[model samples]
Every structure is written in C-alpha cells, then in structure tokens.
Target: MPLTLLPTRASYGPGDPIGIELRGDPPAAAELSVWRLGELVHRQPLLAGAQQTLPELPAGGYGIELEAAGGTVARTAIEVTTDVRARLRYGFVASYRPGKDAAAVADFARRLHLNGIQFYDWAYRHADLLGGGEQYDDALGQPITLDSVRALVASLRAVGTASYGYAAVYAVGPEEWPAWQQHALLRPSGEPYALGDFLFIVDPAAPEWLEHFRDDLAASVAAVGFDGFHLDQYGYPKHAATLDGTPVDVAESFLTMLAGVRDRLPDARLIFNNVNDFPTWSSASAAQDAVYIEPWKPVLTLGALAEVATRARAASNGQPVVLAAYQHVYDQAPAEASDRATAFTMATLLSHGATQLLAGEHGKLLVDPYYVRNHEAEPRTLEFLTRWYDFAVEHDALLLDPAIVEVTASYVGDYNDDLDVAYQEVEVAEAAVPGTVWRRVTRAGDGLVVHLINLVGQGDALWDAPRNPLGKTGPGELRLKFVRGRMPRVRVADPDGRPRLEDVEVRIDGDHAVAILPALDIWQVVHVAL
Candidate 1:
C-alpha cells in the first residue's frame, strides 16, 4: 500500500488549524515537519488515520512532510494566507451537462488550489448568455442548463473560489445578425468578419452593441450570480470596419469598450483573452483583472513564453498573467510523452511568472479551443500536476513577487555584470539553448532567484510538442560578484524531487560566492538569500 496525504482545503486563514486526510496505508509512527523557505519552523508527531489538526501557521507558503517510521514520506504543501486570491491560481469548469455534480467540480478545483475558475462555455449562446430555461443544447449543441450554472456558482463560491461566465465580447450568431448587422465588423471585401459560420464579429465599442451586451450581462449576473465574465475573441480583424464603412482599429476599441463596461458594472470582474497577442499592448492597460493570452502559431516556444509573460506583466502594470496555452499534442502523444510535454509547459510558463490553464471540467484538461472537447487527464498527469502546483503555491512570492525584476541580461551572459553558471563548454544563454541549460536571473532586495530549466535533450523548442527526458547535467556551480559582500544562503527547490527544498552549501572566493547546483532534471529554482 502507498501512503497518501491531501489537505482538506486549498488554503487556511490566520488562526485556522491545518487539517489533513491521511489514509491508504496509514503511516505507523510518523513525524510532521513544517518548513518555511529554507528553515524548519515547526515539527511534531503525526498519527495515522487520526483526526489531527496541525497548529495554525503564519501567512506564507509552507512545505509539510510526514516521515513514517519505516522512512517513507507522505508530503504536501500548505498555504496560510489572509485571502485566497493572493496567489491567483486559476482553473476552469466547463461541464454543465446533465448529471454533472456541481459539488464535485468545486472539490476538484479546490484540490488544484484554484482561487478562480473560468466557467468555460457554460452559456447557451455567446450573444444571449443566459438561455435554456432548465436545460437545453448550447450554441455548439452541448447540454447546458441555467440551473446547473447557478448551482456551480453557489458551490464554487462556498469554497473561496470565484466563477466567471464565458462570453465572446463581439460575437453574435447568424440569427442575431439582423439585430447587430449595423454594428458588424466587416472585412476589406465588405463581408462580415466571422469565425467560420458560427460567430460573426461586431464592433465591441459600438454603442448599440455595448448596450445590448451590457443588459445581457446584467441579466446573467442577476440569474446565475457569477463573479464576472470572461470576454473572448476570435483573434483576427486587427483592421476592420463597421457596416456603415467607418474604419476601425480593433486594438484601440478594447479600451473604450472595457472602460464603458467598468463604468457601467463597477463591481463586475473582467478578464479578456488577447489571442496570440493579436492586440495585447493596448488591451493590457484596459480595465481587466489579469492579462490572459491564448497562444497559437508563431508564439510557440519557451523563449517566446518568457517574452510574452514579461511584456504582458509590464504592460498591465503588474497584473496577473495566464497562458491559455492548450496541449492538443496530448491527443497523439503517448502518456509519458504527454506528461513530459506538460511538465515542460509548466516549467516554461510558471518560471516566467505566469500560470497555465492546465485543468478543466472535472478530470479533463483543455487540449483545444473548444472547452467541451477537453481530454480526460491521465492519473500520472494529475499526480504530476498536483505536485508541481504544490511547489508553485509553496514559493509563489519568490516566483511572482512584483518586486522581483529580471536581471538575466544585466548580470548574466554578455552583461553589465557577471553571474555565470558553470556548465560544460556548451553555450549557455538566457533564452534556453537546445541541449543546454536555460538560466534566468531575477533579484528582489538582497535575494536573487535563478531559474534553471534543463533543455539539454531537445531538438525543437515548441512548448506543446512531446519532450524527451532531460539530459544529465551533473553538479555545477553558479558564480557571481560579491559586491557589498552580501553573504549567500542558497536553497534549491524542485517539485519532482524528494525533500522539495534543500539548502546548498556556498563557497566564497576573494570577490565572489559560488553556490553548487545539483544535477538538473526538469526545472529548479535557486534562491540565493543575502
């Protein structure tokens, strides 16, 4: 029998004792170790199959492990925060089909540690958001019910998770064309711009279109009680026109439409998808909670992911960024290959300070634009994701703290300064080199976090393609100047490894300090505390 441990809730607030469900070959004579950063802050005995509550912890990320008498360890990460939104872990709930359990959906999301959920494709029509009184087919001919939507909202909210209903910002079906034609966004040939035959594009900032959508949104809120809306786009028509031949700059219109929306619905949260970055620069400063990007062609590599995440965060003035980068390759790849690719995607996005929409609709994951077409996640994938998510939650501050600024260019490589990773003669660049270790450097206060992603075995850089296991890059060293003589206290962390975090010994030279780097596998973050 294998030992298993899971937290009862995604997070706990101040003064709340931590609870865990321990079973499945319960440990005999176990000791719990509670660690914060590189320090072991708390430790105590834990009993198997017992209703035990660990003492309340401070507001920060924690790594807890219970070592059984036989030396087996059942481990999990814990977050103690005043608000669940601090980390902003995101997920999706797309199933509104009959017989789908709302409570179960919420539970799955909680386990994923998602504080917000995009209720993907939970509407009858993109234009008429709330239809199908009890239950009816959606725009794509899938079962959906208003009752199911409301129940999901209530259930998710009960767990500290927000629910956002999905709606296309400027889309209407052919049946709605007559009412919205005057505001239609037309192509150069004078034909309406549409996504195939299903959704016709319209000027999002059109006065009439705004008013109509506003009413539909307001009504949806009154009925289903969602926290907000996820406004989507078909990612085209960068230049278009209204039916009356008025020229339109699609990117510029987002600000006007979003501003008007904020003015009308001041309390409603808004999240917009800048698909393939069709118009992110202008929309990033718009009134939205996070910068959401749905990457397709051209924006496919890990280096590109870093660029997008960095630029989006800067453009949004430090807003949350999420990559809706689906993994359709899972359809053709074997289970091991898919998991490896997923791990690569996680390393690329999360290490770049953005989250990925990896899970959705219960046990499924989004593999395509159509949320309903999600693939059932393999048990291996789920287990892998859960551990990575645990690692992410444990040190989100080091990874996403707005104060942490990139110093990769300034301090590493051909630099304004010198911070070098001692890899073999192979070229090491800030942007990952195929068959080389990718090093990204960042600093906040006296601490510097260097992310090392092993790209040593790959020939291609597509983030969604199948990945080969990392090549062994044995113990190396990170050498940097010791200006101001800030003594180093270095700690390394990896989600896929035992003892999630371990302190590494540092050596000091006359003018520099070197921290030993353990053999690289998937991804590792080294925090040099000064």
Candidate 2:
C-alpha cells in the first residue's frame, strides 16, 4: 500500500497550524516537508496512523510532500493568507484543452502567485461569443471543448483563482459578418470598418447590437461559468462613421457599454483594455474591476514606464492597475537578454505599484495569438521568476499600498529628480553603480519607503529591448534631515525572497538622519522607520 497524507482543509491562513492525517502501509520512516513557494520551510518524520500538525507559516501557498525511503509518494497544496492588499497577479491562456491544464492549476497558483487569468481566445467566435456548442475549434483552428473551459474555470476557482472569459466588445467574425453588417461601423468611404480580412467592428452604440452583447455576456456566464469578462477592443477607429452616417466616439461607446454591463451583470467582473492611454478618456466609469493597459510606443524608457503606470493608477480612482506588457523572449532572443528584460520590466512595474498580465500555464512565454506554442524559460530565468514572485507576495504591504504617494526630491537620485528639485535639507549619494539610478519615495506604514530601480548599462530605453545591466556592487549613501533625537532604523529588502533587515548606523548631522543602503539590484526597497 502507498502512504497518503490528507489535509483537514483545502486552505489555511497564515499563522494557522495545518492538520494532516497520515494513513496506509507506510515504510518504517518517512519525511514530510512543508514547502512554501518552492522553499522548504518545515520538515519532520511522518508517523503512520498519526494526525500531524504542520507549524504556522507566513501567508503564501504551500506544498506538502511525503517522501518515503523509495521516493516522494503523495503531495497536496494549502494556501495561507498573509496580506491581501496587493493587486491580483494576472496571466493569460489562449488554448486550454479540457483534461490537460486542469492538473497544472495549482502549479500556477503556487509558483506565479496568480489569482486571476485572461481566458484569451477561449470562445467560439468573436461575434457569437459563447454561442459555440460544447465542442469547437478556436480562431487559430485549435480544438477547444466548452466543457473543458468550464472545468478549467472550476479548477481555478477551487484554488481561489478566478477566470475571465475573453471577448471582443465590437469585433464580429467574417462568418457571422453578413447578418451583423447592418450593425457594423462604416467608414467615411461608406464601406464597413473591417479590422482584418475576417473581422468587422460592430457599433457598440447601436441599441440592438448593444443588447446582443449584453445578452451574450450573460449567456456566457451561465454556459461556461466565467467569473467575469475580459472585454477587448482594437486601438483604432477612435473616430468613425456609423451605419447612419452619424459620428461615433469610440471612448463614449465603450463607456456606455461598460455602464450597461454593470446594470445587467451587476456581479460580474469587467476588465476593459485601455489600449495605450484610452483610459484617459473612459477610466472614470465605475464598471471596471481594474484598469488594464497595453503600453505602446512613445512610452519607452524606465521613467516613462513608471509615469505611464502612475498616470493609469491616478485615473483608476484606487482600483488596481494591470499592465499587459508581454515579453517577447524565448525562441526569439538570447537567454541572457530575456533574463535582463524580464528582471528590468518586472522590477520597474512592481516598484511602481502595478501588477503584470503576462505569462501562462506551464512556464510558457505568451508570445503567439493562439497561446498554443510552448516557449520554455531557461532554468536560471525560471529561478529568477519564482524568486521575484515570492518577493512580491512577501512585501505586498509596502509595494502595493494604494495610499502611498510617489515623492519627487533630489535625495532619491538623478532621473527621479523631477522638476529638478534641488537638495536642501536631505541628500542621497550614489555609489559606483554602472547604470542610471531612479528612486520613488512613498509614505508606508509609519515609515518612509524608497524604491530604487537600476537602469544602468541597459542601452535601449525601450522596456522590451534585451540588454545586460550590472547590479550595484557597493552601497548607495543617503542623508536625510531628521528632527528626531536619536538615529532612525533603516531596512533594505530585495526580491530574492530572503528576509533581510539591517540597521545602518545613523550619524547625527545637526538635526538630520544619515544612513547607507548596502546595495541595490534590479530593484530594492528601503524602509526608514519614523
């Protein structure tokens, strides 16, 4: 007989002791290891016919493995809630076969820490939406079973992850384009506005067309059990002509559609794509669950990345910000280049309080439209990803604090010195780091938090470009004007998933507090207790 471990509950809160019951004809001795995000936390001998209690742990997903004399036998997953303040980590999937992806769900939850997903192209047709029967092939000609989609959604929900179905608000497939042609947006030349050879843009403002979408959305929820809808739109036809030769404002149309959905599917989650900066026009709507944006050109460079995300967050009115900044790594570029790009982009986004909407199941890079292609990440790159994700989970409080504000001062660094704010009472000195240094100051719980991003040696200011940048080799000096009597404590933390708290010696220069940070990497957070 095989040894088995049964967990009392599917999920456990941080600080809660997990209860497990072992059974079956086990070996003389066996070891049970409680691993949190791939790191072993607790290990103990497994006693047959005995109920065991795993020690309390920080909030995160954990895996319990039973290793016998022969090899590992049974495994289970448990989630511990630590801090839920950060925005949901989101990802995507284009092709999800039924019996497959189901078993791999926990891997995504435990590894990437993802709590939401964009079920990209999982529907039958762009126009018909969920009208496809139980079995159909997607636009990419990949076979997909509607039953499998529901199964996947159920499996994700079981792990506390929600699935959002992908649907184009205005796009209709060519096969269904004939009957809907009357509702299609027309061009100034009196021709229908066709997105591609096989798709046409429908008029969202058209009463009947709008009703069609609303009805289809509700039907999709009923049919596939999609928790919400991933509403998409082409970044075009900003201004266009309707079938009746009336001027159509795309932004207003989108807003109207969202409001309508809120009225209809009041409980459904809605995530609209603010293609580029379309949010500037329609972000004020109350129907969106989070502000989603796909950054385009003119917003290249690290500073620009921070600014764009900040701008979107400002417009979101406290809603979470998700960036669909896809990384075109793997098969396309060198492994080193891919690693550098991933580190830089992820660090920049998270440091600015934004969540990323990339990656997919099975450690695959989401590059193609179908999402069927599997681009495996290099071993070292995968390690970096796991560490970064775990770091985000651990430091969600300071990095994801919605109330924190970005302060501009000369003390931070050069690129961050907006308005050329000259130093007066406070001064931050730079080490001999190779790249450009940028810093963001925020007010964290009873402390001043400073985030450092290293852009040095990265030639192209473009966020997607691949290049190697050296990490800071020495400490960066900081001097602040402190009115407090004694030296203040300083803490430096990186996304290496390691707990690091060091008190830097603070020298009293009149009424100022001066401290030094050991080093900075792709990203680092410095907390100065008040």
Candidate 3:
C-alpha cells in the first residue's frame, strides 16, 4: 500500500494551524515525528485516513518525519516564517480554460512550496490586459476565460500564493498597432520594431503608452483578481527611436517604466524579466520584488549558470532572485539522464540564493520558453524536486538569507585549509570542473555552510547536457583546522538521498574538528554551528 503525507499549503504564517493530509493505511508501529534541525522535538501515534491539524509550531524550519517498524517511512519539510518574501519560490501556468482544475493546480504548487505563480499568457492581448466579456483567446491563440483565471487566483490565494498576470510591457497586437502607431518604437529602417509581423513594439516611456499600460494592469486585477504583473520584454533591439526620430535608450526607458509601475501599483508585487542579463546592472535595483533573469546563449555551462546567478544576486543588492531557465535538455535526452540534469540546474540556482520559475499547473515543469509547451516531470525528477524544495524551505535561514556570503575560494580546497574536504573516487576541484567534485563554502547567519556538488563522470561543464546520477558512493572526509571556544556541531543533508538533517559526530582532535561523510550525492549542504 502506498502512503503519502503532504502539507495543505506551501508555507504557514505564525497564527495558521498546520494541516497534513494522511493517505493509505498505517502500520501498528506508525508514528509521526517533528524535528527542528538535528533534534526530535515531538512524536505521537498516527492513524491512516485521519485529518490531522497539527498544533501551532514555532516560527522556524521543521522536518516532518513518518516512521514505521523502526525505520523512516516518509520524510517532508515545512516552513513557518514571519516573512514569506525571505525567499520567492516561483511557478507558472499557461492553461486557463473554464473546465481546468484550479484547486488541483493550487494543491500541486503548495505541495512544492511555490509561493508565487505567474499566469503565463492569460490575457486577451499585451495591450488589452483583460479579456472582453468572460471568454477570449490570448494573444498566442490560447483559449482562456475570466472565470478560470479568477478561480485560480482565489484558489492560490487561499493557500497564500500570490498570482502574477503575465503582461508584455511593449508588444501590441497587429490589429491594435495602427490605432497606436504614433506610439510605436521605430527602428533605423523607418519601420516599427516588431516580432515577425505578429506584434509591434512601442515606446514604454511614452506618456500615453505608460498610462494605457498602467490602467490595463489595474483593470486586470479588478477583473480577475491578479496580485501583480509579470512584466516581460523581448531581449532584442536594445536601442530604438521615437516616431519623430528622437533617440531612445531601451535600458533607460525600462528604468522609467519600472518606476512608474511601482508608483502606480505600490501595494502589488511586481517582477520583471531581465532577459539574458541585458540591462540587469541598471534595472536590478528597480522597483521589482526580485531580480528575475531568463538566461540563454552563453549561460549553458555549470560555471556559466553559477556566474549568472551570482551576477543577478549582486546586481539586485540581495533582495531576492529568480531564474527562468527552461530545461530543453530534457527533450534532447531520455528521462533516465534528464533527471540528473534537472537536479543539477536546481542545485546551482538554490545554492546561489535564487529560486526558479520552472514548476507549473498540475506539478508540470516548464521546459520551453513558450509557457504552453510544459513537460511532465519523471517520477525520479518529482521525488528529488519534492525533497530539495522541502530542504530549502527548512533551511531558509542559511540558503536565502541575504547576510550570507559565499567563501569557497578562501575556505576550502588546496591552499585554503580552514574547512578542508576530500573524497575517494573523485577529487575536489578548484572551481566547477566537470568530471570532478565541486565544493563551495558560505557564511550564513546561524553557521558556516559548505556545499558539495557531484560532477563526476560528466563529459563537460555544460548544464544543458544529460548527466549520471550520484548513485551509491563510498565515504568522504572533512577536517576543520581552527577550532575556537565553541566546538562546532556538524549537521549534514543531501536532499536527494537524505532529506532529513543528520547530526554527525565531530571528533575534536586538538585544534581540529573532523568527521567522515557517509557519502556525497548530487548535492549536499553541510552546516557547522559554532
């Protein structure tokens, strides 16, 4: 018999009671345990088919473990935070029909701890943010209705998920271009910049255009109850001209547009797509909830992925970051290998203190830029995804806290022997070197975090290629050189293989604290509390 235990929502506020759905039959020895970090704080007998409303938990990360026959049967995690904006776990959905299952979609997102969802292409047009009457086809020829959109908005909001309507900031439909031609952005060829004659671009900073955009956004919220807008743009034609031949710098215009958006919708949550890091340096500090980027082109390798994440976080001045990286690698390879690729990219983003806009309606994953072209995640992919998101939520203080600073180069590897690490079959490389283990170290609020990623047996550092799983491995090693007054208590977790945090024995040998790792999997986050 299969058994499952899932939280009713992604996250709970301080006053909300935690709800757990229990399915399948439970053995006589079944028990539910609650853990905070390395210590087990609560345990009680549990029955199958029971509606469990857990008492209020303290504000912190927790591991909810279900055990039977003296072994852990299932493990999951939950977060009770005072501020959900500490980390923005984003998801998206493009399907918006009247018959769609809005409740089920919200359930899937909440289970994965997705607190922010973008309704991709759920509008009548870029210029007309709301549909006429109740039913209409979106700009991309997708059939959507106001009923479904509002249903999803209400469902997601019930679980504390903010709904963002996807709004193309400049694109105007072909039929609407002529009426607004005077506001169109002209190229040097005396033609309005357009996308293959399907849609034309407009000057976002124009007074008339800005007023139209803001009014439509407000109407969308009033019509369908959207919490905010996902501002979009095509990453081309960096420079354009006004109809009267006035020079226009696209980046500066974007800054002006964002400021106006913030001023108009001061209470709503806003997120803009910084496509390929274009003008991110200038707009990172703009009026957006997070520094979101859609990476492409040269950002195909593992090192490149990490670099882009770092760049976005730095440019944003540490508010929050999101990567809309579509995993086309799944289409190139079978599910067997593609699962590893999915895990690798997720690890790279989460470790860099950024979330991903990948998950969508019904637990699907966004694998293409066209939001409608989502793909079903393999069983293995789903399993690891659940664990990783759970672990991240449980360790938000270390992973998403802006006060944390990465110090891999100065703390680990060759010459830097502060917290040295070693592995058998693989050697710790200086950087993200393919066919070798990648080691990283960060200083967080509660402790020092050391991240280890398994890059073994990989042909190259490219993130878009399939990879081998971490599989089973022998023990690894670690040694801390300088031991101060506080004898560090070591805690380790590999969300893929071990979602529960385990307290490892730290032997104090004179001035050093040493330990032996049972194994290293796809990724492991080790926290040493001083």
TM-score of each: 0.94, 0.82, 0.95
All candidates in order of lDDT, best leading: 3, 1, 2
Clashes of each: 0, 2, 0
On lDDT, who's better, 2 or 3?
3
Give the residue spans of candidate 1 off by over 4 A.
Answer: 13-17, 23-25, 47-51, 83-86, 413-418, 483-486
lDDT of 1 by residue, 29-71 (tens): 6888787775788888876455457888879888777777676
On lDDT, the leading prediction is 3
Candidate 3 lDDT, tens digit per residue, 1-530? Answer: 46667787888899898877776666676788888765787887775466566778888888888888869887777788887766689999889887889988888877788889999988887787764668988777788888999999999998888899999888899878877889888878898999888889998888889888998998888898899989999886688888888888989889999999888888888988889998799999897888999999888887888898898888887778898988887778988788788788888888888877778798788888888998888777777678888888877777787778888778775577688778767778757887777888899876788888888878787777788655444677878875577778888988866676687888888777888876877888888886
Q: How well is each residue in 1-530 modelled by candidate 2, as lDDT tens digits?
A: 44555455434556666777665665667888876534478899876466778887777555577787887665555556653323567876666665766646545554566778788888888888766688878776878898778877887776566788998889988888887888877877888887768788978767788899999999999998998988888777888887777888888888888888878899888888888777454654556688888777776665677777888878877778888877765557887887777777787788788877767665667654445665666667766776676566556666665787766454454554211112232233232123456666777667777777666555555667676755443567666666456557766777652333335676665655667666656677777776
Q: Give candidate 2's error at residue 442 in angstroms.
A: 1.5
* Model 2 TM: 0.82
Ranking by TM-score: 3, 1, 2
Q: How many backbone clashes does candidate 2 have?
A: 2
